[model samples]
Target: MDIFEDKVILVTGANRGIGRALVKALLNHGVRKIYATCRDLNTMPSLDDDRITVLSLDITNDEQITTVAVLAQDTEILINNAGVINAGNILEGDLEGMDNDMSVNYFGTIKMMRAFAPILKKNNPSKIINIVSIAAYSPLPSIAGYAASKAALFSATQSVRIELAKEGIAVYAINPGAIDTDMNKGSDWDMPDPESTAVKILEYVADGKFDIVPDEMGQGMYNAWREDPAKLSKIFSDLYYGEISE
Candidate 1:
């Protein structure tokens, strides 16, 4: 499906990073409208375009999701891009950190699907995009809880894809590698700019590329995964510069 024209899209975590970049990308494509949502409306960066409507939405909150669903009833595309990373590991990760990661990354996104999938189905031929990560394929030992949450989200994405297919709603999962965003601040590895990354993702999606892993690292890991899933563990382990002790 071509997403570049005459579509109403809703993006979560639109205040900054990839989500923010996507808003601009969609605008450039001449999409009809965009419901750009963030936790705090005031914190949302102003997009000069009148087609963009900034809304306050914290996906973890069911009431807010329901409210936004009603408000954006005409939405044809939903971009689940909100995410969080907690600094912890399975061996000694903080309980709160794990819970926060799970609540935001896994449950939050799934809940968003639950709330919007019906609305999208009503629109017919609508689409859903989940911004996942390469970490979902293999655990990153340092951010164990975050990786685990993304892994769960990856599974959920597949299941949702199957279930939503019959309803004419396309479900696409974006497994981005290390994106240069505030989320990855101080990372030792060089990361791709989120703006250019968004451009690549949108262009590929327009051509019907379902599972988009835009960056070099993401594509490399995906190629390795196609050959052998076991290689993924080693690929990430080496990137971390530490052997997986667990």
Candidate 2:
């Protein structure tokens, strides 16, 4: 069962970053159709493919979610790749930024999953890929709110994976680290491009991986977190304090 081959897939946040890259990757993988969505349709690039359908979707908006669910009723794979990162921490950081991050990264993804769950059930043997972050495991103090939101999403993904296990719906959590996109342009880490990241993530999905750390840095960080969560937290703390190069 090759998931990407001839599958009707829907990807959120398809305007740029991992979402945009995933669209191109899916096309190369020979998908039958793709519903690429962004909050603002104008931001979506003109992808010259008959199989592609561009739609306006703000996951935080319930109306839009319902509309997309109806429009993409045949979707076999739902990719919750849309997210936002606001620069805020627990102490003396932008409160509004934190709220925005929670709204977009945590609540928005959850709403998408809820809306698509029934549709995925109708299609059976489907997949739901949530683009979480490596920061989910360890909160980087610099992006504390973003990390916290992803952490919430990570927990929710696990719960959904369990509940949907017997229903033929595979829920996957993709925790990626430092992909070179507009989102991470402020950082100086030598990051892998989103194209490579997307390829790796899709490969993992095809391999029946449930929880994937889709890059070298993410793999290392995942290993560290698995070995000792406290140690990973300390490393992130050091990075925040300039005691270590992030």
Candidate 3:
């Protein structure tokens, strides 16, 4: 099914970064409506169109998640794109940083999925796309907390996918390697453009791909996992530690 054609989609964290690009791509695909939610709707780049609805939403807040879930019950596509990155190791990092990362990346995603599961069930032939990170598959030592949170989300996505399959609803996990966004401004590695990543992701979703790894790096990680899981972990660890032994 061409999921974006005349469908209603709700995208979280749509004010900027990849989320905003996703909204624009969906609009180009001729989606019927897009509820773009962010912490500050006013900051959202202007998309002068009647089809787009700007909403103020913080996914970490339970009340806000519930409210938006109710308001956008007719949605056929739910994109959980909201997340935060805490730059520190799990053991040595501030406890608050770990909590914040989990709150937005893992728990926030779970909360949103839980709140919208019923609506998705009611609206059959729906899809829920979770924007997980490459960190989910391979953890980095520096960003252990962030990676752990995404790993949790990745596991949750699998469980939900199996449980929702019978209801004709598909759950997708989108793992894109280092996209050029504000989230990774300080990183030295080359990253793809957010707009391009958004386009590829939407295309994959429309084609009903379950695990959409959009970039070459992501594909390489998947290949490594299939060939040797331990080797892949070592490669990631080496890269994180600047070992230059890939």
Candidate 4:
């Protein structure tokens, strides 16, 4: 079945980056309506389509989430793609930076889930898709707080999946390696295109896959978990530190 055909969908952070791409892809898949929520709806690139409804939303704001949840009551798919990355190591960074990262990435996601879980439960066969990162599995020093937030989100995704399974709602966690987005504008590593990543994610979602690793790096990390966890962890540590250790 083409899950997106005639489906009503909601994608947070739909102004730019992966979220924007996902909104376009969902439209291409025959989605009947899409609520594209961002901090400022006017900033969203012009879609010039009647099916796309631009909404102003700040995921961290409970009132905004509640308002939108009621407005998008027919939504069958919720894409939690809004996130923030604070660049700093755990030791050197101020507590505020760490808290900001957690507030937006982890708590914000949880808040959205809490607000929409009931709506989703009422609309049976709905699904919730969370955009996590490979950093969740392998933390890096430079983005320790960002990684920690995502790690917490990954754990929450697992718990949500288990708890919601009985309610007939499927929860998915999509962990992607570096993707070419404003979030990593100055990074010096190869990153996949946001559009490509979005397309791949939608494909997996259509197949009802619960967990999606959207790139080679993501698959490698998952494979290493089974083959050699310690070695993989050291490899990631060395990559971030520039030297191998005993």
TM-score on alpha carbons, each prediction: 0.95, 0.97, 0.94, 0.95
**Model 4: residue 187 alpha-carbon error in angstroms:** 1.5
Candidate 1 ranges beyond 4 A from true positions: 241-246
RMSD of each: 2.2, 1.7, 2.1, 2.3
Residue-level lDDT tens digits of model 2 in 70-185: 99999999999999988766998899999999999999999998999999999998999999999999999888999999999999999999999999999999999889999998
Mark the regions of model 4 whose C-alpha exceeds 4 Å error after superposition. Answer: 243-246
lDDT value, residue 187 of candidate 1: 74
How well does candidate 4 match the true structure in TM-score terms?
0.95
Q: Each candidate's lDDT (Cα)?
A: 0.90, 0.93, 0.88, 0.89
Give candidate 3's whole-model lDDT. Answer: 0.88
lDDT for position 71 in model 3:
89
Residue 12, model 1: lDDT of 99
Clashing pairs in 1: none
Q: In model 3, where do residues sit more than 4 Å from their true spots? A: 243-246
Ranking the candidates on lDDT from highest down gives 2, 1, 4, 3
Tens digit of lDDT per residue, candidate 3, span 100-177? 999999999999999998998898788899999888887887788898999999999999999999997899999888
Q: Which candidate ranks first by TM-score, i.e. highest?
A: 2
- What is the C-alpha lDDT profile of model 1 across 1-246, one tens digit per residue? 245588999999999999999998888887999999999888888689989888999999999999999999999999999999998778898989999999999999999999988899999888999999988988878888999999999999999999988999988889999899998998777789999999988987888878889999888888888889889888777756653442
Tell me how far the alpha carbon of residue 228 in candidate 2 is from the true structure, in angstroms, after superposition.
1.1
